[model samples]
Target: MAKQERAVRTRRLILEAAGAVFDEFGYESTTIAQILARAGVTKGALYFHFASKEELARGVLDQALTLEGILPQESRLQEWVDVGMVLAHRLPAEPLLSASVRLSADRKARDLFGTSWPAWIDFIAGQLAEAKAQGEVLPHVDPGATATLFVGAWTGVEILATAHDESGALEKRIALLYDTFLPGIAVPGALRNLDTSPDRGARVWKLHQAQHHARQEEAAAATA
Candidate 1:
């Protein structure tokens, strides 16, 4: 059990180190040696987890559409909002996600490896569709189209924010984006109830962690 846990931790460390390198140098410019240096792990250890740099890049891309820091909400729209807010909060702090975004935007990298954009669009559209079924969306809103637009807009904001590298810029821009789009897409009452706060991500993440710990405790109790 300890060996398995150690292997898992080692793999995660390598991925995170590779992600930081990719975030800084991009996929094409990044090298396995650099990743090894950053990770402080042996080449054999890295190869055990991931065969190559391309595989590591794919791993990063795979994480692009995560729900790691989200909690369920009564409002489907609010659930969707929490997803975005949590992502916004995490993007700056998490190198793997930032690297994924960087790789997705690079034309060369896209030709070599696929991106997470389509999946993200589909996931958001799915959420919006559920919200629509619940009568949370405006009459004329098309869930898929709106999802595509949101994904594009968010990516654009991320690019600009990355260039600026200003603190809280991404979160603030994303919050305003929801504020601008929600009125047109959401039912009036739902829109009024929804939160687009820049700090929403932080709050949701805390709740998510608490819920996860509670679940872990319950599972341990059950086993005991």
Candidate 2:
């Protein structure tokens, strides 16, 4: 069990190191040696986890559409909003996610590893579909179209925020995005119930961490 945990931690360290490198230098310019240096792991250990830089990049990209901070909500639309809010809250602090965005935006990296945009779009569409079925969305709202637009808009907002070095204000910007957007697609009743506050993402993430620790404690107790 200790060995497994160590391996997991090592892998996480390598990924984070790779993400920081990839973010600073595009995938084409980044090398294994740089990753090894950043990760402080031997070359063999890095290879054991990832066969090549491409595979490592793909691994990072796979984390792009995460549900980590989002908890189940009464309305799926609210859940969808939480996804964007949590990302806005966490992306600045999370190297892997920020690097994933960088890679997706980098033409060379995107061509080699493919972008996570499509998967994100699909995930959003799925969420919107559920919301529509639950009558949270208006009848005329098209899930796929809405999802595509949201992803594009979110990407633009992220770029602008990063360019301006306004990481601190990103949550407010994202909340405003949902505030302006939800009214167009969401049913009146559902819209009223939705919370798009700037601090919501932080609150949700804190709750998620508390729940996760509780679950871990329960598991440990059960084993004892």
Q: Please, what is the TM-score per model?
A: 0.95, 0.94
Tens digit per residue, CA lDDT, model 1, 194-220: 888999988989888899999999999
Best by lDDT: 2
Q: Which candidate is the best by TM-score?
A: 1
Candidate 2 C-alpha lDDT tens digits along 1-224: 69999999999999999999999888999999999999999999999999999999998898877878789988999899999999999999999998999999999988888899998999999999999998899999999999999998998898788878864788988999999998899999999988899998999999999999999999999999
Task: Please report, as a residue range, the 10-residue window in candidate 1 with the lowest summed lDDT.
Answer: 63-72
Q: Model-by-model lDDT, in order? A: 0.89, 0.92
Off by over 4 Å in 1: none
Note the residue pairs that clash in candidate 2.
none
